[model samples]
Target: MTRLVDVVVVGGGQAGLAAGYHLRRRGLDFVVLDAGAEPGGSWRHMWDSLHLFSPAEHSSLPGRLMPAQPGRTYPDAGHVVEYLTDYGKRYALPVQHGTRVDAVHRDGDRLLVETDSGTWRARAVISATGTWSRPFLPAVPGRDVFTGRQLHTVDYRRPADFAGLGSVIVVGGGNSGAQIAADLALEGDVDVRWVTRRPPRFLPDDIDGRALFDVATARRRALDAGRGDTGGVASLGDIVAVSPVRAARDAGLLKASPMAVRVDRHGVVRADGTRAEADAIIWCTGFRPALSHLAPLRLRGTRGRIATEGTRAVDEPRLHLLGYGDWTGPASATLIGVGRPARNAVREIAALWARS
Candidate 1:
């Protein structure tokens, strides 16, 4: 059976829902296809101890504010899930849970969104499928020969999982690596070695995601006006000092060591020609965009990213890519930052649809 909509949102996460909200404002017919079995998207699978980098009120989609949690500066993973689930309902967005998009290709004037449940030919397609589904693990030399268990940020859950391990090596310098290392260190008994390719950089204690978003916004505005690069969140530094990370760093437990030059059958080989034995390795290296379903479009460049003019694909204007990162729009990957890009993308789609 074939279905049709003015727009088909490929992922029902924050980016998709935000785009949906604006689409409704423009009176466009659309449906959101989510691969998750439930409404929360990737938040449901995030680590149990995870918390938003910003407070509840600071993080929201287009239409409603996330209800603040009592006695907490930051909302936990479960809180985010509840908020996202409610956001979809509050707007009465048409989201089809458990529908995984298998492919997207041209179907004459419309794009065919083929999914596990069915197919929908949409006049425009918004690919908001964020990077959570695709975890990246670096190919460090001798990683194939490592005898220890390896895990990525997506696969990690709790510190208790490593209760009996001799030593745990966490690889990466970002927020995930810092937090995961902190979580494991909080266990008190586990030996944790945090590794980074370069020296780890920590943002000041007062700065959070909201501050970062503001900086990014300023940088974008400056660039748009030909004011040259004013620098964004990277200027502030890397990891934010959320409570756990702050405590871990203050206690001298989250100190970063240089990344091991190579891995051995037993563990890792440090640059000093010394070996560190590890029972487990957690790779918090980050993720690539989840665009495998868009492969049929053949729009990706040598850089492995789709070239875009704002959110619209350069090669296929009918398609828009959202929430991938700065190339699509500055700070578009964060909850607080995605709304602008989503709204802009939908407006562009609406204009194109009107002309067609």
Candidate 2:
């Protein structure tokens, strides 16, 4: 028999849990379907040495503050995992773990969520499947011909995996690329090269995710007011000078080169015709939204995103997207940012249900 719910949250990560929290407050019957074997969402898959760009107090969900970890300025990945697990348990959020949703489509007025476990018919569906599952790699010439090890940020777990390698090339300009390059440089023997399409933007030493979020929030407010642009505002893409990154910069290892023109059997070949022999290459090239499950709905817009006003889809009124990125809501991918959009989406869903 197909289970029916007022809402089905597709993902059990921070965003999904946040949606569940508000849905419960609205007294809606809902279930969160998570593909992971356990809780914590993408935090569980981050590299071991990863740290939050913001402090614990700044990184939290809707109802509870993430308990601060002693002696750490920024909580590590493990701390985040523990906090998320506790958050779900604390609210008794109904989550179906290890359930992979394959597709979502409309069955008349209700939406049908087809999963590996079974089918779910819901009055509304919130797709919070964030980007971790969709790591992106640029199409570099001869990439397939290169025989050395190649890994995207999603596959990277630790620098030790590349220990003893002669030379390694870390690609991308974002925080992931900077952090991974720094971690590999700590090994002290492997020749590490950082490559980016453009120069990396390093925020001031004192600036972190908290400050960046504030700047983004302000920019959003200005845009809402019909202001033309907020050019001076900082972006979440700007790298926060966390300790390790600072150390790398101090050691002069944070310097970046332009992206390579191609990859050969030996290593990366730059536009200048210099080939850096590399034993391995780690691509921190970022991720795309994990929205493949919504293919049956054909709701994709520009850049493979579901066009939405706030969190509600423009084409499909009952559909909402959360935690994907700013397109959904400002800073919505962050722990603290997810709450606002989740609340807004759930409120809208509740109102629609009431009218129905």
Candidate 3:
């Protein structure tokens, strides 16, 4: 039997749920399909010490405000998971958890979403399957030759996991690298080396997710209005000094090294031919969009992204890609940031239905 819906949301994380919220409000029939066993999505897989860039009050979805955690300035990964779980239930959004999408392609005028469970035919498909599952580890030469155990951001859990290891090298200068290095440094026993391709850039202490988001929004507005270039998020800086990262920087615990050009059997080799010994390596390199399920559509570019006009795909009119990052919408990957794009996506879908 071919199940059918007005809209089929792929990946029931914050983005999918947010889309569901707007879809429900417009009286549109939709279903959010999530691969996770429960509601939290990728947050459930984040490191133990991870916290949101902003306080809970500023980091919320469209309809509901994330309640503040008592005594915590910024909510942690666990808190985010709970909030997402509650958000889904509170809205009574139709979400089929544990449903893994295998492919999404066209079946005549409607889009066919094939999954492990069954197939759903939808008028519109929103790919909110964010990048968590697809961690990006650059092919540093000799990476396979290294004797040390290698892990990506997705595999990391807590600092204690690296405890007792002789020397640990953390790669990438982004927030993940800084925060993970800080977590390990706090142990006072682990030998840690943090490395980045470029020197680490820290946003001012006063800045948080809210400021970064504002910067992105301003940039988007400027381009849309044809105003002279106002610098985008890059002007703000790369890493947000969350509590642990801030403390580590102040304490001289978060020093980073130049990127390693290659890995050797013993350790990593720097560009200048210096080899750094390591027992383990943690690559906080980042993630690529999780769109392998859409491979059948052949819409992905060389960079694994699709052509988009706002949230809607340029080539595929029936598909909307949300929450992948800035390319989808301003700050579209964050908890608060995703809501606007989610609304825009649902609105476009609704408009399409109306026109049809």
Candidate 4:
């Protein structure tokens, strides 16, 4: 017999868990279907040393507070995982771990979700998978010909992974690139090169005590323009965007521009006729929207990412999307930033369910 649920949420991370918990609080019937063996999807896979950029106070899920530490900065990835696990236990949120959802299909006013475990039917769905489902790799010529190891920021576990490498080239100007470069530089005489197609912009942390307000203004502008694309607010990308060149220069990681680039499996040739060599290349260029698992739901877009008008649900109206990169105008893509949009989605879903 196919089990029925009011709403079947995919991806049991902070976003999914928040939606599920909120639904439960409202006495709504729902089930959270997660892909990981436990909660905290990417947090589980994140680099060991990675910590939340947001304060712990802002990082907690619905109805629960993160373990408090007065005047603390942020919690590490492991701490995030622990908090999520405890949240499930505390609320008894119905989440099936290790249950990888393959496809979600609409079966006449209901959604039939296929998974590795079993099939579930639900009247609605909340996709809380978030943006990091897949890492985006850029196509650089002769990329495979390089004899050295290459990795995406996603696969980067620790600086120890690159410990012995004498020289390293970190691609992209995102926070990941900057932090990795900084750490590598700190680890003895390791040569780190940061390659960014264009120079990144910078904003100082302490500028008349209005740094926070400046960022808030930018977000508000994005929201007003209807492009609530999060992920660049304080992310590795945003941090680097503020002044990557300066940061890299100060760390001795900056290099001359390659005006004309040609890869011969050894080095990058500049358009101004200069060659720079690298041992390893780390591409933090960014990621493409991952919707392979949702192949069945033929959404109206080039990628499976459904383009929305305001916050309206696409593809299937009953099936709502939360954290579908750029779907939530201007709030940023982090869990803390995604809360309001998720709540808004919940309210809209509730209204739709009530009408149904």
Question: What would the per-residue lDDT of candidate 1 be over residues 35-96, giving only the tens digit for each residue?
Answer: 98898878899887899889988998877998898878899989988998998988889999
Q: List the candidates' TM-scores in order.
A: 0.98, 0.97, 0.98, 0.85
Task: Put down candidate 3 lDDT per residue, 151-218, tens digits, no spaces.
Answer: 99999998778767889999999889998999999863779999999999998989988888889888
206-284 per-residue lDDT for model 2 (tens digits) = 8888887788777777877899667434443467788999999999988999989999998999999988888889989
Lowest-scoring 10 consecutive residues by lDDT in candidate 1? Answer: 181-190
TM-score of 1: 0.98
Measured with C-alpha atoms, the lDDT of residue 294 in candidate 3 is 82
Worst 10 residues of 4 by lDDT: 205-214
Which residue ranges in model 4 land beyond 4 Å of their true spot?
69-72, 207-237, 240-262, 310-312
Alpha-carbon lDDT, every model: 0.91, 0.91, 0.91, 0.68
What's model 3's lDDT at 12?
93
Tell me the lDDT of candidate 3: 0.91
> What TM-score does structure 3 among the candidates reach?
0.98
Q: Candidate 3: worst 10 consecutive residues by lDDT? A: 183-192
- Point out where model 2 deviates above 4 Å: 231-237
